[model samples]
Target chain A: MNLKFKHKEVRVFAPASVANVSCGFDVMGFAMGTPGDEIVVRRSDKNTVTIKSITGDEGVLPHDARKNTASVAVQKFLEHVGFESGVEIEVHKQMPLGSGLGSSAASSAGAVLAINRLLGEPFSRKELLPFAAEGERVACGTAHYDNVGPSLLGGFVFIRSTEPLDIFGLPFPESLHGVVVHPHIEIKTEDTRKILRNDIQLGQAVKQWGNVGGLVAGLINKDIDLISRSMEDVVIEPIRSVLIPGYDSVKESALAEGAIGAGIAGSGPSIFALTPGEESARRVCRAMKSRLDDIGLPSDEYISQINTKGAQVIDVKD
Target chain B: MNLKFKHKEVRVFAPASVANVSCGFDVMGFAMGTPGDEIVVRRSDKNTVTIKSITGDEGVLPHDARKNTASVAVQKFLEHVGFESGVEIEVHKQMPLGSGLGSSAASSAGAVLAINRLLGEPFSRKELLPFAAEGERVACGTAHYDNVGPSLLGGFVFIRSTEPLDIFGLPFPESLHGVVVHPHIEIKTEDTRKILRNDIQLGQAVKQWGNVGGLVAGLINKDIDLISRSMEDVVIEPIRSVLIPGYDSVKESALAEGAIGAGIAGSGPSIFALTPGEESARRVCRAMKSRLDDIGLPSDEYISQINTKGAQVIDVKD
Candidate 1:
């Protein structure tokens, strides 16, 4: 059988994403611009996937094709498309692993995008989301789309349901900027999930959903003040903040520096603050870093507007 | 102190609202065009508020100024504006009381608007919400704003927080129409409130909030399909539907007749269906009525476009 390939090699860039998003926990996220993963895929003669190389993961990420998120995601895509030829994958980690920045999602998203392009784009970016989520299942226990959805679909994404996989992108203001500060500490997603209560008060749930509606309205209308007011987490933050040192102080610093709102990103030790503009985002990032500095902890800060384009093909070679 | 009156008498029409719009629960509602209360306020020589008469309530509503929602709301408004003159209020109840169509809210909202205009428009309609809420407090045990907010605000209103009185209007499609079916039996708001579980599973809460977010997004974007998908209530509907006979069948009938979505209108007995336009709304209303008819139950049906102009001055006398 003749292999139909648009490009012999393809390189793709997939963005990091911030999930949970305060009151929108387990449902909302947005892609970021700076910290991302780059993956390269080249056609192989043998019908077997291979993880040829991995970079910048501090020697921790798996090298086996079945174990690595990038390779696993690629394999899923290949199987879905019934591709007979195998692909050699190279994983480049641009963001901190387990930093609440969707590190695994970026790798998985990038890998799928790269392989799809090499195979002449069999699937649209959105169709690749499930394959990317499979990577998240391999990395974690749940196949949650909060991280991978945004990382693949771009902009602000809302996951309405996970079972039937209903997700959509939300409109945000052009002036909106995001600041994410990741403290050099790891809080496993599983541990954070364990800390949350199995049940919540009906009143609290009402308040949380109220904020969720308000937040979505605020984003749609581009009402900065309303957005700031609605960015509150009544359920999860209080329970999970205990895992992050100086969480309160860091959030206060971001707000004090004119951030629209601030909250724990994903599962934390990463804190995210939204600002009206890039300058304010930078100021908020500095303030958040200073708070962590006061506690004698190092942190990595990223500033970006919402990534409107998710995964992009950077290079293609015949 | 002299009472400065712009007009000797003022009559206002305040809309009946559907609260707890499916997934929105306690935070969302919208005004209806028909079956609203018409309140007439005439300047009285005496300095104390009085209820002159109430029509269509079958003598069930109170005549005492302190107990009557209309008079109490006007009293609150008069006190807030420091008006010395008393006003005689006439409550014209156009909608069924205790039908979960926010009948009390209509009375309170209409009274406040009428009295405000009689007192030379001392407060904006938005400013009249608290006074109307006080009326709800008088009727029900707790002061909730979901009903009064939209009845005064004239649109789809979202209450972010009740304590600080944070509320905002959400944009929806111009073609949106509402169908409300009030089954003859009354399910008291307090009884419906009692039946709800104090604690709900966290997963259900997440799903509810996700739907809330999706609903808001759908409204803003005018995505009819998303609106239908998001009009699901996983928490309150399951518990409260038992109180209303043939609840599922009635909702199914509405949906089957091309309604976008349908659910219990508040702490129902009243079921509301939303559709793309007036024709579909009428069809859905008929379908819902037929379902109730199937069970040998009588029901009152209302068809309305959203009341964009919430309360209006219908008459004035000098």
Candidate 2:
């Protein structure tokens, strides 16, 4: 019997994500366009995981199959579905780490989505989340789904359960716009985790839940007034904001420029602004970049709509 | 010319509530039927707050208008809305205090609803919530809206935010049955507050959020499987459950008897069990009660459906 295969190679686009979207702390996340990573995966006859190419990195990322985010994610997916096949994965790390652009998550999500399609889509998007998170472990020393879920699924995501595995892709409120400022600085997830307190006050915890609940309700009901009122961090943002230069000034300036709310982007040296419209988003970007520039730092900014499409097989080449 | 003036008295009923439902901690709360407080407000010429009668308090409650739960709430409402005339409030406190039944909240809610009607409905239900919470402060010393919102609005309530006042009443899943076994012991809110540690581990906090998210999604989607799976508490229930007699044993017995979940009610002394049907709710209630009895603490129990109606004006005289 002769079997002919078509559309054998897949090119995946995974959007950059903003993890810990202010009020949600560890559970809320969303994806953005412009600054994301791309992964290209192909069916191969190799006996082991192989990374065929590397691009967009400053020659710092590893080419080893086990070390690459896409390759490890594919390996994890193979183990997940009990599949015994080898494939070649390529990484294009467009978004820089420590820029708070979800660099590792984008690559991890893109590779998994690409390879899963190549493998005939045996696993659902949610089933592939843990694999993406596992790949994230290689980059951050911890498996966090905040960025990975949004990167893979796109839009606004609420990670409802991690064990026994449940996640919710909530509806993105229409007319939502954002500005993300990436200051050229380096801060590893490990160092960021270390600086956070191991314990938090019960009072602060109550406030955190209040904000999370408000944020969820705001998104669900499309109540922009409530969303702006709820985007607050009395717990971690106050502590983590110090890591980024001009963080407070940038946030204040962003809000002053018609942005409704501003917060640290993930565990960052980067920050994000939520605005009501495209005009406000553009103004926020200008304000955030100017704040960073005033502090003698080179900053890259993206004014974007909330990316509703997570990870997808944009093209296929046999 | 002869001018005749007539006065019409208004009465309102507010059901007793249960807050911090199992794993929800500060976000989830719901109201109950049958054993709730009733307030009858009569329009009077004098500018004074007065509590005329009280029942079900075993003569232990205060008679002074300032000290009465319903009276104080009416006073706050009148002052806030600038009502110049006096109103006579009669409080029938049917639910017992310190039973985790939200006894004080019911009276507060009943008064606010009754007064709103007596004054020709000057404010929205959401506007009256803080007034109810203010009355709750007379009993609990703090303005935690968990109980007040549910008592005022009914159904399954999620207090999304309290700052700019965001409260959402989520749809109660069909076939949801609840069982309550009150141990007849007093567990004050202050005691519950005092026992909890000021600082909690970040890991535990994350788990708490996961459970909350799961519960919210379950409510939104009406997924019983998700609801049962999400009924867990690593924070408040664990520490406070120690204060309730046979708490662990009762919970185990209830779950074993087809209960979806069971936990210490409010802070302690009362235990609640959730089931999918009336039969299962009855069986779980019996099983939980028997378990408590075996531990030498027999309790009063109720098996009912989730209360969908909140506070409303009533005609007690009729």
Candidate 3:
């Protein structure tokens, strides 16, 4: 491939994401502003991808380029663009792993985005979703986009289908704030997924889809009340919440602190609440954290508006 | 309670509705423009409700005020307002019964709307949904608002819940046209519902809600391609289509005729297709009817844009 390199090295930051978003399990998600993964990509003389270093994950993440999410995503991008030269990837994990805040997705998104910048931007950010999702497939068994979609593209993303790759960016209230509290506990996505029932009642499914419709409509119309009312999970949360300690109390505290709605973030060990403004988001975060404190569980809390600019190039070296 | 009547009599027309709308089973529906039911209501000195007459039903409809959907809705509305004087209702069923075109919902919506007009409009159109839904409960043994919601409010409606009565008006493309073809057959709602499996696979539910979110976003953004792509029913249609003869062929014909999407209207012997404009709608209507015609099955077809004005007073007498 005759692709010219725009930069010798590039750095990118991909935001963390809250997937499922209560009623919209496996379909809807939004990017957060902080606690995201960073990827550093450098043009290499070798013809193969390699992961040079990792940080913030306590040496838990894989270093092999083929096995690691970041390198896998970079490798996939290079293959797609038919780049003869390879790239070296460095992953800086700024968030908790297995916390349900889309850790793997962030790494993948950051890697691809960073490399895309280095390669003179062969594809738009939207076009890079599949490569990021491929990394998700390596990390988890399924190549779901609910995480990578929002992480890469920013804002609220509604993934219609993964096979045909039908994804949509939904409009949300400008004042909308999200409070995410990740308790210092590990709950693997694969494990939480295993605990879910294979079959759910038709009535429950009906209620779920109704809320899904309501949530989408609420987000589009920026109806906070409607969004609050629709942010309920009758199917997955009921089963998954059991895995998180003090989940019920933490969620109640968020709501009591004037949050519009609260639910298990991704596969749990983290609880997220959405409020109308930053003040309410802060209040919700404090309340949720206090509940965890009372239960003697340490946690990390984040407050963010919707990250409208998803993965971006932070710095580049020629 | 004393209430001055603005009119001695009032007549209302409530349009028929298509419920489910593919991926949004039991939660979404839209109002049609024609082939609706007409309700004439007259104030009476008697303290009890009465069904004065019924037409176009071939005597299949009930005359008993307590049993009939129209009278039952009127009775509920009267009791709510503490009205001592009763009202006599006359139902003119312009649409076919047992055809999955929201037959009972139209009668109920028209009755409540007509009576409310005669009583000086005590309830706003939005406030009259429960009364119409009560009539639905009496008719179907369950108070589902998907049909009555659109039939009463007009436009596309996303029903979040029937219990707390959370219904939101959704914005849709004005150029959108619907083609409904009612195959002259009876498939009872109760019977078709019985055939549905109580439990659905979790994966299927995920895909269904994904599409639900997609459809709502599509409607809000007025993206025709997204709307068409999202109009899929993975759970309900596969089971219900068995009862409708030549359902596959009919749907294929509609799609081949340039319909954006097509699905069983409500519980179905009626199938509805949505097209981008009047031209494609007419083509789809002919195509669907031809499929039914090929099987020697007689059908009635109606082409309509969305009925933005749902139930409205057509006439008044002092």
Candidate 4:
């Protein structure tokens, strides 16, 4: 019997998400556009997986399907739900690596979402979250859902739990607009985690929790003033801000330009300003660019609204 | 100078409040009725500070003006606003001391509120919060606003900051019902604070903030089910519950009997149950009492609603 060669391919794009959102620390995240990655997967009748090619990585990313985030996620998905076949994965990385803008998560989320559709959509969107998070663990050493949850599910998300025993996803209000800026630099997530203190003063802990609560309420109620007031960090941001250039000036300038608030995005190199409208977001972008110029650093800005649509199959070809 | 009392003496009773409200830990609180202290202050030109009597204390309380909560609160109020004349303060200690019902805060809040009225209401209600907190420090060794904020201002309160700069007095929904039970034993607030770990895990911290945010929403929306579900703890209650007799049993029984949620009140010795209606509150009281009985402990239960009217001038007798 001769094996028939038929090619069925699908490609999906997942947007970059700004995790932490300043005071939210771990619970809140928002999706962004313009800077995202495209993942393409082709189904084959072989029991083995292969990485056909990779672009825009500049020789840094692995070509092995099992090693790359996009591949690892597909592998995990196939293993969990019992897949009798394998596929070839290709990643077209548009977002910068280690930019703190969910670059790796975009690929992973895109891959899982695209491949799941090719597999006839066996699982729900939430069921794909842990798999994509597992992909993030390949690069960051720990599975942090802050980035993956938003990238996979889209819009603003509150991760109630991640311990495998019990996980909760709360509703995020629709009125929030996330303004993200990616400074052309790299700050690894590991370094960001290392900068944080193992122990904090009791007084600082109370303030941290207070801001977290305030930020959550601000998001839920869509209160711009409360969100601005709540976008403060007395713990991690204070410590992590030292690594990023023009951190204080950019954030202050953004706020002065009518942006509700701005803070170090994720672990650094990327900064996000939250504003109420496109006009304020544009002013915030100009202010941010000026601050970066003053500090001898340049940045790319995106005045994008919060992306409510997370991951989906953009195209399928037979 | 001849001492003459021109104005009528007013006695105000403010109910105790449960601070930390499970997962809130220090940011959220709500007022409760029954088993609360009463403060009576008289306008006098004698400039005399006095504590008339003390009761419901098992030798744990002092009757001296300097040591009593009511006297200390009135004295602090006078010094803060620079009252030209002093006032006489009397305490009717109806609530049990060291029962975690915020007994100290009730006396302090009631005294400050009554004295403020006696002085022609010179300062606003919010201005009396710090003065009352000072009195609580005299009894608890540390100045905490959780109990004092709610007791003085009433309803649900979120203590955003606690220092020379404090933020509180947010609007709370009027639909909350707070059911409490005080077992006839003593659990010192100082001991409770001492037993808590100074540092908490980051995972637990996230959950704590999520619940706190949920609680604020619960209060704002007047959603009883949300309030009940948000009543959870990852830091304080687990450690404190072991000290209270039948704490787990009572909590389980209360929830089993239609109560939304139950947890250690303030710092234990008193446990509170939150329910939607009078019927559920009564059921919770019975459940809590039966748990106390099973554990061979004598308990006093109070089925009460959230006290929207905090500390007020009940009567003015010349």
Candidate 5:
């Protein structure tokens, strides 16, 4: 039986995203320029989905389409389009696993793009979101689109609701640069999700809601100072940050260095800071990364503007 | 000694405002046309603040300048401007007392604007928000800028923070009309505040935050459908609506009649609904008013375009 494609093939790129963006935990995210993932898909002769190869994930990810995130995403896409033909997938993880940079989501976003392209482009980029979000249900215990939504749609993505699957892109502030610091430590997403309390105080909820609204207002108005003031996460940060070492010190360091706002990225281990320009972002990255270093934890830092283009077809083959 | 002003005076019109706006409790507010308060500020001879007269409030409001919301606002303005001269204030409450229409905030907002204009505009309109918020502290148990901010700055105002106060006006959607239904029964703001639970479930809080962020996005983008979908109030509405008569039925009726969203106006007897155009707004008003009518409760219904110009000077004395 032939396992490879007859002729149709496609490759797609998907960017890593920063979920929560400090104040909007589980509801907002934005894409980054580098350290993304890529996937290659080919329509095959065999009537079963196959995972050909996965790089940079340390061979830890499952090969079965049902058990893997990107492959599951491909399965959802095929099921959605009613395409019963077999598809082979190749995932290249440009980012490290457990880095709090939406590594799993990037793989899923990339695979959907490749599969969708291979299927004669049956869906628009926006239409590919649910299929990618379905991948999240397999990667994490629960399904969410805060990561995949931004990773697929680009810019600042606001997940208004996941139950009804309402998501949209927001305006990225001009001159805004993201300074992300990934500490050389591993923290499972499930563990972070488990740490949050089932109940929250009303006062704390009010503060968090205020910040979320303020952050959205800040972005749309291009008010950087307002962004700095509103990037506070009163609910999830206090609980989840406890699991990450040097969380408080790193955030304080970034704030002290004139960074607009600083908080833990995604679930944990990685912290990010936002600044208006390249210089301040570099300055903030240095301050935050050095603070982590003080705690005996080495870190990897990346600086880039908000990625306006989300998942893209870098190459397509017929 | 003449209690009234000797020569200089200024009167400002402060529009009635809907605070909380269903989802944004204590953090969001928007102004409405007509049925507002009028405050007249005049230069006095003595170095003391006094309330010259109070109308439409049944003369129940405090006469002492330090205790009265309008006079307290005037005192704060004078202190902020470093002015030693005394001021006399006259408040005409066009809206009913305890009508859930931000009556106290309207009075406070008007006094500050009149006082500022009388002082040759020592501060801008945005700068006077804090002074007006300070007045809310005298009226309500705690200080909040949701009502004062919109009443002073106009349009859709977001109260980011009260400390070192940061507030900005969001773009008001065009062709958006406000449909307000105010029942004759009065519910004190303090009573409503007391009935609220100090704690809220994390799930509920997350829903509320998502809605607030969505609402901000909808208003900025002028997405009316998104606004309708995002106006769900999970925390405050359920709890606070219990205090109002026929709250649930009224909301259901409004939704059935094509109202975008509806909830308790501020803290109770008054409930407001939002719609895209004047026709739907009027239809929603009839539906809500008819519901109240069935409940054996008389209600005053107001239909108007979302007031863009907040407080204005119908007459500016030089």
Candidate 6:
């Protein structure tokens, strides 16, 4: 509660997220362990915010505080909470851009969580979700919490809405492991957005909604077989899969190798498959990576369990 | 159940049903307490099916066994189980036609259940769902189980689909009461179907699906407050409300009278509100009836609890 003797420099890390999650486009996402972003928030004498540096962005990232997601989140938080001390932020993008792995969400979520911790934890984590979602808006032209919510809150997060920001920490099977494959191609979120149809058929919508209900019920009941069956989304996957390289092949390979379900993560170039345990995760990862390589889109695979603790304090310096 | 010593005459009563339940269109429904249909199944010496008499339909109902829902359902049941010998069916319609209160579903459900009882209970109640649904298809041109599922299985029935008949008997608060108001008018389901849009916008679909998931979760958790909030059906109610007389005024009055939520029951011409107990049910019924009266549409009100027992034998003679 006291901030006078707080650490001068604090760094926090937020995990990469897989959004859409098949049946729930823009409404559901889950956190992965390995690929993540870190943000460093340092105290200064001046009563203003600044972005000192951004690494791993290849010089394309902005320096201004208002324009960038991490700094904008910091700016928004400071302005709302009336924390007037100067804060300098350094964004370290460990995740790849345009990988559909929620890279932008990680940076913004890490920044706000770190800055909040450094400034004595003035706001609750739930209160800070909107700022992270707002940061995602700057990167993707939409304020969606599917990625940012899970990245910040950890585990599997279901975002019912962004307005007033309703989020639920869904109960997923503890043994669930995610096999994620990120290919070396850059498919902009905007370009992926262009592929999706503006309007959906009624039959498809009903079928998809039924699957959504079944999926939630599956998670709540801890029925892995039900989860695998309910994850068969009829609406978005049929259309959006065309944009991803070796999409069908990857899904087929993953399922054949004991993965419960596989689909395009977020907007795609990246793909993810959910398996029951670590063994299936490894098998699915290998299968998916092989499919991508056979299709001339050699990719990197990461075997991860669901990140239960989202963003956490990595280091603090005096 | 032994068929050789079958009952000479049997009469079965099936409770009326409320389909859709706002958020889940064509996928969910529940049975109400009163104003249900009665069907008489009699064993005859002749080797042909016949409809002896029809009541309460004012001769609008077909006399041919093949054309009627009750006889069609009976025929389907007999054909599936290879039951021989002649059977006579007498139709009785307790509820008004096109009341948006599952009148057709009640007829089919009552018929199948009664015949199943007469033939010695060869099929379980779950297996009888398809025959009832098939009978519903003859009545409404769609084999949806929203009405028939609840009318046969009772309680809060959710039909994920009718193909393999994926149904969940959702655990709802036992004290929940339904207040129904049916105006002296008829809106054909076919006519109501013409008013609905064929395609839905992506944003609306996501919000609707999220609410559906929330609804299932709320029912599972027995969180009444959450159910009340999650029952908002933005996708269906907006488009279908136009078919009902004084729809907005009636819904406004119901919610104003402390009803948790109110919407068009299945299609139009009838409105129902869910309340916590009998007292609130009475209050909501009065509020909704007054609204219909103010709009010059005198309506009848029914305050009933959930019909946990779907269809039952009123009288059976050996």
**DockQ of all models, two decimals each:** 0.90, 0.58, 0.93, 0.44, 0.78, 0.63
Cα TM-score of candidate 2:
0.94
> For every model shown, what is its TM-score relative to the native structure?
0.98, 0.94, 0.99, 0.87, 0.95, 0.94
For A63-124, candidate 5 gives per-residue lDDT tens digits of 87799999999898777666677988888888878888888999999988887767666678
Model 4 lDDT, full chain set: 0.78
Q: What would the per-residue lDDT of candidate 6 be over residues B1-318, giving only the tens digit for each residue?
A: 225426788898988889878788777788998889999999988866788899999889888988888888888888877777879999898887888889889989999888887877888888998898788888899888888888888888876655555776777788889888999987889988887889989878888888777777777777787678767788889988887879999999999999878888999679999898999999889989988888899887788998888888898988
Of the two candidates 1 and 5, the one with more favorable TM-score, higher being better, is 1
Chain B TM-score for all candidates, comma-separated: 0.98, 0.95, 0.98, 0.93, 0.95, 0.97
| Comparison by DockQ, 2 against 3, better one | 3
Identify the candidate with maximal lDDT.
3
Deviation of model 2 at A53, angstroms: 1.8
* Residue pairs with backbone atoms closer than 3 Å in model 4 (clashes): none
Runs with alpha carbons beyond 4 Å of true place in candidate 1 = A1-3, B1-3
Question: What is the C-alpha interface RMSD of model 2?
Answer: 1.7
* Clashes within 3 Å, all models in order: 0, 2, 0, 0, 0, 0
Task: Mark the 10 consecutive residues where model 6 chain A has the least summed lDDT.
Answer: A1-10
Q: Which stretches of candidate 6 lie over 4 Å from their true place?
A: A1-6, A58-60, A316-318, B1-10, B313-315
lDDT of 3 by residue, A1-318 (tens): 568778999999999999999998989899999889889999888888999899998988999888999998888888888887888888999988988899999999999899888988888888999999999999998888989999999999989888798887888999988789999987788899889899999999999998998999988888889999999999999999998889999999988989989999888788999999999998889999999999999999999998998988899999
Candidate 4 lDDT for residue B75: 86
Native contacts conserved, per model:
0.94, 0.54, 0.99, 0.42, 0.78, 0.52
Proportion of true contacts reproduced by candidate 2: 0.54
Residues A66-146, model 2: lDDT tens digits = 887778988888776666657788788777766777888899999889877877676789878999998988888878899
Candidate 2 chain B minimal-lDDT segment of 10 residues:
B1-10
Instruction: Point out the higher-scoring one by lDDT: 1 or 3.
Output: 3
Give the alpha carbon lDDT tens digit for every residue of B47-68 in model 4. Answer: 6687765656656678788888
Worst 10 residues of 6 chain B by lDDT: B1-10
Better of 4 and 6 by DockQ: 6
Task: Give the alpha-carbon lDDT of every model.
Answer: 0.90, 0.81, 0.91, 0.78, 0.85, 0.84
Model 2's lDDT to the true fold?
A: 0.81
